[model samples]
Target: MIWVAIAISVCLGAAGQIFMKIAMRDAGPFPGLIGVVDIARYFWGAILSWPMLAAIVSYGISYVVWLGVLSRADLTLARPMVSLGYIMVILYGFYAGERMGWERVLGIVLIMIGLFLVVRSGARV
Candidate 1:
């Protein structure tokens, strides 16, 4: 159960990152140090936008769940489970319009296999 929660937290965290990337796509990079009010005013629209808001919410939930997972599971067990998010994030990136070449796809597949091997190793330990 603790491992499950940790995995879920990782998924939420990955999703949050993806949402933030989508939100920033049109908004451009972080602005150079300008007037305080100017920077604040410019980001006010983005901070309140749906994608940004979703990222915030996802992060909040992930933090809470991670705390719960840590209380029940050893860090070693919980942390490795989070590697699943690499696979999740790669898929999300592809779905969100990032063009994935064959090399990237093969790399992601290798990562998934590595994650599975790690899980099998944990069973032995």
Candidate 2:
């Protein structure tokens, strides 16, 4: 189904973000444009890191998958559905030892609600 491909692409994107976050733990703030030396510290090491590499590949594949999706679906309908990735990444954080409070829980629930409506409505909008 088209929805299945959409879900795969969304999951790939969310997983990429999660992998990048894990790879950057303790790396501190991103270096400024003027901080060339600081940038160097994060650059090569990150490019060589397995998690970062995985994230890059994941994102690359997700983009490819999205191109296929665009050919078969309405962008307006499919774009909103992509918000499912936000919910997935937030839940990943919660389960990965990050502290999730009530507000975030509510926000996730609201995203689910909106996604549900979007699916039910099809491409009518």
Q: Which ranges of candidate 1 are over 4 A from the true structure?
A: 26-38, 123-125
Clashes of each: 0, 0
lDDT of 1 by residue, 6-92 (tens): 778998999898888877875677787878987886688678788999999999999999999888777766677777777888888
Instruction: Give the local distance difference test score of model 1.
Output: 0.81
lDDT of 2 by residue, 1-125 (tens): 78888988999999999989978874656677868787897777876788888999999999999999899988878998889999999988888989999999999999989988887885642
**How does candidate 2 score on lDDT?**
0.87
Clashing residue pairs found in predicted model 2: none
TM-score, predicted candidate 1 vs. hidden true structure: 0.79
Each prediction's whole-model lDDT (CA): 0.81, 0.87
Best by lDDT: 2
